[model samples]
Target: MNVEHGVHDAPYFVPSPSRWPIVGAVALFFFALGAALTVNKVAAGWYSLAGGLAILFWMLFGWFGDVIRESQQQQYGQQVDWSLRWGMSWFIFSEVMFFAAFFGALFYARSIAIPELGGDTLTRQLLWPDSQAAWPGNSAPTSTSYTPMGALGIPAINTAILLTSGATLTWAHWGLVRGRRLQLICGLVATIYLAALFLALQAYEYHHGFLDLNLTLASGAYGATFYLLTGFHGLHVFVGTLMLCVMLARASQGHFSEKQHFGFEAAAWYWHFVDVVWLLLFVVVYWL
Candidate 1:
């Protein structure tokens, strides 16, 4: 039996003896241990969490860099591209399901739990009469106070910025397909810069929310869920921005050409996906 990178005809040229799996598993183990201990007031848990985060970040950097290097070497074929596209599609699908769960939870809280708890129902009248039934941003239960992040201000500006970045990335993809190296490089650079700006602005927004608006994750269930969802999405945006930045770096190094540029395409796909998701999030989570 022919064996290449542990299996013949495997997706992409996964280098032999990949260590990311072991690294990831060990990091996860530490993360769990730290989480458990932290909940129990153990002093060493914070150190464990820090170590796990460091290891996880290191693993991601190394593993993704290796993949980027391999792709630039043109060891991947059409079959490999197909496999990658499929993988991305499925990954996005899983993300959709993840967000769907949160949306479902939101619906349950607003449509059922809150109303019932506020004595809108026959059985809950005696239990939680002091609670208020309201949508998250407008008004929430009495447990916490927070201001809703509206879409008319910075959120709208961020939407425009992300949309523009998406457009520039599309232009870059066009340049790649048409064999315009300068155009491709310019477009990639613009997109990367915009992404960075978006992240910086987001951080500023978070600071404003905390310092001025008193919006915090610990404020209430609304604040908790809002931060959990938007915070995770922001983390993804940060990651996507980093991916684009690396693509820009590779573009500058003349690593990708018109004919062979799957790495560029993959980053574009991921960024576009992030932009679309942000649009929805802005409308649903921030605006409405």
Candidate 2:
């Protein structure tokens, strides 16, 4: 291997300064303690969860702000950049596995459990009526049968919005490549807006589910699975949106150039992954 990749991004060595970690740790302690207590509400579980969340956010702001400053000051080395990439890649991989587990559970429930429980003929006949194991709208009792959302309605619109945002982000990337700062800024703005819009539409859809269709997490096995799949995906979307906002902030500050925009690349990868997951959920959980 090449002995060195030029003058790396970060400094060779610096003073071990700052007590951020200790403060972050203390903040986390409050957050965790608050969360645990808040769970018991009357015992303060709710307050604990709230306080912990606040502390967690505080830590993130201070911690990431410090890293951003270091990165911007050119204290980061190519090695540091590579490390960030690998860490993000591994995190995304873990997220994939997490979703895979949920999807697997969904598949088993739809394909195996429901079918076996509602089968007919001989012993099957003793099970229930000659029922077919359906995905959402299974032939189970009304109380347990869960109906998926319609694909053409809000979900399809959300999908389109996300895709369009992805395209805009690509344009922003190109603008960065060509060093068109103003155009890049516009692209980032558009992407962020589109992401926010997608989130709003999803919220609306969830409201419709609860108020109009009476479908909810408490509906039974079907309801439970539906929420488990869609809820987590929605949370991911929210997270991806925040990442895009960060990229936008960095872009506006002229942090990236055509050659050193891996941060943007990683965020885009995550957003695209979020989009793909939503599609799968729409089809398997909604349309299917």
Candidate 3:
């Protein structure tokens, strides 16, 4: 533990250099390339994508294992903890901006593009003479039927599930802080169960929308925005569920203490964020 002028100095833990970042980056490159190729129907793309996903999963497992070991060793001091907090905070902020972009696109398409297309004579003459630029607007170049999804069905149920999950997560956090291991474990299990249920119901809803209701990515502007927003949010929920599972495993292993457990805290924060985002999605994408 190196210290500068003894009075003002504190031990700052700098982890030894690791190869995980580079490995992860390379894996992501392959994943992206393979995904693009798959979308274009290139040969071997599926295999390439599967391989890349396997490598990425390996990298995450190794990297997270190392971190857990370091935490167990108490290698991280308050300084390191503060650094981790700041890092997670910034990462979450970046995620917020990421979702904001898609929301903005939805806004633009609804408030500006759809209205203009419906109102302007030139657009009507050139593109859709008989189409009305109403929401879930009939802007598709082809004649594919579409039905807008209502907020009163599976979406409403999912909202209730997310809200309940958030409450259970808070209960788990309380247990963690109070050193009640059983309560913490139970709460986490409940949260995970709820998340799985949410995902299942959402998948069912998507199926209903696509296959039964004739709502699809190509239905019109509404279809495009609808799927884009819900799809990305669903992905976030999936990632958050994985994080919660990891936290649950660590909690069961006695890896977290009352005063120190940023791993769990970070996961909880992310889950709460996912919950908040879904609420917003319900209001804007589904209700409005």
Candidate 4:
């Protein structure tokens, strides 16, 4: 049984012991600690956060490098492929649940908390006599006066950009499946450019919100929910763009074939997930 080579006769390829898992755990610990400290206004927290990010990136590069090498050596079998598929599926599902939790919070704030507080006569009289049961109420203690963000302008453009990126990503997938390397690379480049543009425009919109509209985290529930949803989605878009960049590099290196390209497919799945989430956010957060 040649474990290193992952002999075809073996039931499953089991890798030897590695330090990456513990390293990753340590990195996460620092990340969490740094985040907590930073939130409390500790200056040293920046250094800790930067260090943690460096360690995390190092672990990712090393760990993924090993997996890629193993894959290129044909160490993975059909069972391993299926395992990877299931693993990616579950990861995406967990992400879905994460976003669902935030959306649930938004629902609770809008449907139950706000209405109960404002609609009840005694509760309103005792608690917040000046507050109204509005969707974007300016009644919180820390609330700042601001104009609500609309569905037009940069948001509309960003929506189109994300939708177009999704199309370009699908085109890349088609090229990969057809064994058209040039087409695949071109499509990936277009998708990456679009993704970057979307992020840039989002950043600009955030700036506009904070500077011109006075929309901020302190601007009551509307601002909080707006940033929470859109901010996280933007992070996902940045991550997806990085993933697409990795796929582009792999494709350029002649890594994937017409049949075996789970890495590319995994990135595509993530990008599409980001796109769908943005659509939901556009409707729930901006339009309606």
RMSD of each: 3.4, 3.8, 1.9, 2.5
Which window of 10 residues has the lowest lDDT sum in candidate 1? 1-10
Give the top-scoring candidate (TM-score): 3
In candidate 4, where is summed lDDT lowest over 10 consecutive residues? 1-10
Q: Write the per-residue lDDT of candidate 4 for residues 1-288, one digit (tens) a residue.
A: 234335544556787789999999999989988998999999988888998999999999999989998889887777789889999999999999999999998999899878877785787778777777887768475687889899999898999999999999899899999989998999999999999999999999999999999999988878888999999999999999999998999999999999999999999999999999999999988888
lDDT of 2 by residue, 1-288 (tens): 123345554234242467677777877887777766666565676666677677778778877787777767666666767888999899899999999999898888788877786665454577556566655654345565444568788888988898898889889888989999888889989988998898888889989988888788777567778889888988988898888889889988889987888778888889888878887887788777
Query: What would the per-residue lDDT of candidate 3 be over residues 1-288, giving only the tens digit for each residue?
Result: 334323432776667899999999988988998999999999878888988899999999999999999999988877778789999999999999999999999899888777767785787788777767788656666838777999998999999999999999999999999999999999999999999999999999999998898898887778888999999999999999999999999999999999999999999999999999999999999999
Winner on lDDT between 2 and 4 is: 4
Model 1, stretches more than 4 Å misplaced?
1-15, 137-145
Quote model 3's TM-score. Answer: 0.94
Model 3: runs farther than 4 Å from truth? 1-9
lDDT of each: 0.79, 0.78, 0.90, 0.90
The better candidate by TM-score, 2 or 3, is: 3
In order of appearance, the predictions have TM-scores of 0.85, 0.86, 0.94, 0.93
Q: Which portions of model 2 miss their true places by more than 4 Å?
A: 1-24, 120-132, 138-147
lDDT of 1 at 70: 74
Looking at model 3, residue 246 earns an lDDT score of 95
Model 2 scores a C-alpha lDDT of: 0.78
How many clashing residue pairs appear in each of the predictions shown? Answer: 0, 17, 0, 0
